[model samples]
Target: MKQREFLKKEKEDIRILMKFAGIYCRENHSGEKVPFAFKLFDIKKIERKEIALCSECTRLLTYGLTMRLKCPHDPKPMCKKCETQCYHSAYKAKIREVMKFSGMYLIKHGRVDMLYHYFK
Candidate 1:
């Protein structure tokens, strides 16, 4: 894929994961959305999604986006099926929990289009 396409895909994936993590966090935890926006956050290019998420989930999102931003793949494969894992073990486990939870939630809610690519 072209660089633009790759970037777009990365952004979309981030949005979906963030939304899913937000869903899980909202149901499983208690916290607030910090209103302060930082200048260094790279996710501005993607819309600032306004979902309410806990601080931990918020941190997970920052980590997740950072991982995506540094991805070495030209046309990235699904992270689950990738041969090389870039994330630290703790992060990998945490993200896997989030993804699995959100994947099932998405399937239950009929968001099959996203799953088609990820779970294929």
Candidate 2:
């Protein structure tokens, strides 16, 4: 699929999954729609920076049930451009935290096979 179409679907998927996983939404001070995609520190009200996944990774995550045990980064895990844009100066740490939380959550919830990719 084209990038725009892919992102549209992924965004919709994120909305639904986040809701299914029990997250709420709020409007930012500027009155823009913001989903609960970010953790506490990345909230729109607190930071103005909209946190998001790389389009590629978001696509991968949208199919959360089917990722393989291969690191998308391969030699070194690199952030997708969009994720880089979102975190700005703190991109590195934020991505790490996201990865860390994802791994732990999957493991805690008994998704052991999925955790393997994050380890790499």
Which prediction has the highest TM-score against the true structure? 1
Model 1 residue 105 distance off true place after TM-score fit, in angstroms: 1.4
Per-residue lDDT value at 31 in model 2? 35
* Runs of candidate 2 exceeding 4 Å displacement: 1-89
Question: Per-prediction TM-score, please?
Answer: 0.76, 0.31
**lDDT, candidates in the order shown:** 0.70, 0.35
Give candidate 1's whole-model lDDT.
Answer: 0.70
The per-prediction tally of clashing pairs is 0, 0
Quick one: best lDDT, which candidate? 1
Residue range 1-120, candidate 1, lDDT tens digits: 223433667767766766677777876777566532323454445658666666777777777767776789978887777888888888889988888887888889898787775555
Give per-residue CA lDDT, model 2, range 1-120, as digits (tens): 211222333333343333222211111123343233442122233224343444433333334312211223333233343332333345445334445555566667787765443343
Please give the TM-score that candidate 2 achieves against the real structure.
0.31
